[model samples]
Target: MTPRPYLDITPTQLATLAPGTRLIDVREPDEFTGPLGHLPGAELVPLGTLEATLGGWARQAPLLLICRSGGRSEQAARMLARSGFRHLYNLAGGMLAVRATPVAQPQG
Candidate 1:
């Protein structure tokens, strides 16, 4: 079998995600609610239970994986790819990077 394919999305790029994009955070629920506040529509799936939640996510929309640091999310992406999911994206540096990123503001 061939290696599964996936994509990466940087923190800066994440700030610009289109409306309704599904951001699945594979981190623990506590981490998700703590500092590094999540994006508007991000959902907490947690790495341990991601497999069970995959089916419910909207496959047609862009699926972005996230975690505390990125390792778990990477694993999630691999699993999702093997399950025939397309448009899979792993947050490049996870919440650390996301927190470091500066959200752009609209200019009047």
Candidate 2:
């Protein structure tokens, strides 16, 4: 099967995620804690559990996959893409990079 294209973005770009963006944290639950807090509104689906957890993903919306680093999330994104998920994005550098950027507080 042909590989699906991934929309790779820097941590700064994560600030752009709005209500419509489907943010997915592909890191393990333990890894999700500590210094780097998760992106607000992100759905947690550990990479190991992705296959069973994917049934609930919104097929229509663009999926932004994230992890401690870019590696695991990219793998997860590719798998989802192969499974017919259309819009897939890999957050380049993942949470580490995201944490480095100055976060814009969500407007109330």
Best-performing candidate as measured by TM-score: 2
TM-scores of all candidate predictions against the true structure: 0.82, 0.83
Over 28-103, each residue of candidate 1 has an lDDT whose tens digit, in order, gives 8888899877877888888888888777666666788998788898999998877777788889888998788777
lDDT of each residue in 1-108, candidate 2, tens digit only: 965467888987766755587888988877777578798888888999999988867776788999998999999988988788888889999998887777668998
- Model 1 alpha-carbon miss at residue 10, Å: 0.7
* Candidate 2 accuracy as lDDT: 0.84
Clashes of each: 0, 0
True-structure Cα RMSD, model 1: 2.6
Q: What is the TM-score (0 to 1) of candidate 1? A: 0.82
Give the runs in model 1 whose Cα sits over 4 Å from its true position.
1-4, 15-19, 104-108
Task: Report how far off residue 80 is in candidate 2 (Å).
Answer: 0.6
lDDT, model 1: 0.81
Which pairs, if any, clash in model 2?
none
